[model samples]
Target: MDQTTTARAKGSRKPLWTKDFLITALANLLLFFSFQMLIPTIPIHLSQLGGNNVQVGLVIGIFTISSLLTRPFAGRALDILGRKHVLLVGLTICALTIAGYTYIAAVTLILAARFVHGIGWGLSTTSLGTVIADIIPPERRGEGMGYYGLSNTFAMAIGPLTGLWIMQSYGFSYVLLISTILAILSICSSLFIAYPKPIPPTNRAKSQRFTDRLWERSALLPSSLLLCTAICYGGIVTFITLFGHEAGIPNVGFFFFCNASMVLLVRPITGVLFDRKGPEWVLLPGAAFTITGLLLLSYANSNLSLAIAALCYGVGFGSIQPALQAWTISRAAPDRRGAANGTFFSANDLGIGLGAMVLGAIANWSGSYALMYRFSSTLIIVFLLIYGWSIWSYSLHKKAAH
Candidate 1:
């Protein structure tokens, strides 16, 4: 009926798949594949290096902590230095650091490499959402983002399984070599995409001191909510193999296989849901799915039960992750989108680190992965309560304002 409404509808019709979008999506795939390939292999490598559960958790988690520290800086760089430049530097760092792993044998050296690797991960990944946001039509942001996120989702499905198979056949060095190649391919892909020109900060924003530039406060709530899921994920990534061994399952790769497949299948639908129904509805079910999966994991005795658990977790993760990221973008001001992404990722990395270390400690103390998983499952319940309270409070605030 209204001219503005008509214009907005037309804008939303802008094509989702452009040349630049394809290049960026491929670049995202390569980047995530390089990282995801190592997710399970690294813990196994650490175990071979004679690390205890706690030490293994620490090594696994320290990467996220390192990445977390660099995210704010990376966000700032994306805004000021430009996305392409920051992304290129990050990719180079990742490629070189991964290559270094082939020569590394000592645990200290391995940890050092992972630390540097995280900086690259933090910088490149922080820019990815920002780049996709810039390219996609604003009205179709949620749908486009869900599609964009599938790059990572698809990689997650294949990466671990491939990496584990390679490690089983060849060695850790070969896995690192393949990861390095993927990172190099990602760098080549990124070069083809024409990145958006960096937006200059406002006069007021420019005047603000260093600390003010460090966060996008508006993104904090969804970021915090995401943290809950990420923590449980870290535990799974870091310890699932050992858990599988304890349960007498010979091949734990099937868990990632099932998990990744479910995520790949469900993510597109969840993206549609975010665009059509909003994030609130998507996130609650996502959380419920994850909790159910974790609870199943705690009680699982057979391969069938484990597969079911993976499927549940995968669907939940697929739904929640993109919706939370879409909500983060929706809440932020345009100029601060990079910062919002950075903040959201930082929260994700922090939760992951905490989960690995904390859950590892629980495993150590209880002497059972089942008990640890049960403990981890409780965290989701806590997060749900917190999320519910926040939603209720926000509703009340809106009513009062009206």
Candidate 2:
């Protein structure tokens, strides 16, 4: 090949993995690991502190509410203040608040701490996602996002189990200490990641002076769809363990182990399919898988049945998440990507918060987590139909343009 042709080939070859990406992913994993450890422990801690179900729910609920409230501002901060600044601030706050848990016993104090922690979570996660979007090559976006998302997947797999073991073996104080230490480690790792300079906003330059900046219109559609999927996912996270206990399953941790394992195994393939064949090829079948998993979970009686459900849900979630993120990224202008990611995550957290309340109520009303899963399955089917309609409409629009 000629010298120019060889150079072109090298330039066009997108690097799916990079040093910055790896550092960011590792930092993200540590951050999530620290957060996830607190998830199960917090409720137990609150109960031990003489809190009832209502108080426990309020303490848990406030965190997401705070995060959702913070995300829009965090998005704007990423664009205006730059990524590294916001990220470091977030990690510091997260670490400090977690450490604060060691000193607090009052439910009110705990609620305050939780809100601060959620703010930290919001800022850090939004900045992290924007940083990845800034660095990842456009051609390799789906593949890159898949690998990045695996960090969170791994955290989900291992964090709760480790936290529960630590808390059970030692005490809640030890869990707090360990989580705080991990948060510090996450900050240290984040320091090594080099973020690119922010792109100056062009379209919104005039409006920035006067208008509110909470939502990114470009990110709305995909984010909305993500909200739907996350509602069902949140239900799974909130009740799956309890559901297992109620159903007479002894080793419920195996379900999460299976779920995360499938996600890890299938993500690379789904990413490739997303890049090569577009999201329609992945998303339609992914929705089917998710619905099927929910159905299986609803009926599961044995370990084998639960494993199958986890496998299906894992594959479906692994496929759909990166594809939706890639789609959201594609819709935004370069300068607006930070807001895009913020909107995306905000919708996600909202769904989780809503699902916890709504689906929990359903479980309580029906007196069965299994029935709640059945309800969640129906929601997924509705989401699929909506997603399908959007794809169809977009296709028609493209044809009309042609």
Instruction: Report clash pairs, candidate 2.
Output: none
lDDT of 1 at 41: 92
Maximum-lDDT candidate: 2
lDDT of each: 0.84, 0.86
lDDT of 2 by residue, 1-402 (tens): 012123233446577578898899999999999999998899899999998888888777888999998888888888778899999999899999999999999987898899999999899899889888877777667777888888999998899889999999999999999999999999999889888887777875537642345567878888978888899988988898899988988887788899899999888888777766677777888888999999999998889999999999998888988888877886777777778888999999999988898999999999999999989988777777777788788789889999
Q: How many steric clashes does model 2 contain?
A: 0
Every model's TM-score:
0.90, 0.93
For residues 307-365, what per-residue lDDT tens digits would candidate 1 score against the true structure?
99999999998888887887787777667778888999999988877787789899999
* True lDDT of residue 208, candidate 1: 73
lDDT at residue 131 of model 1 (Cα atoms): 88
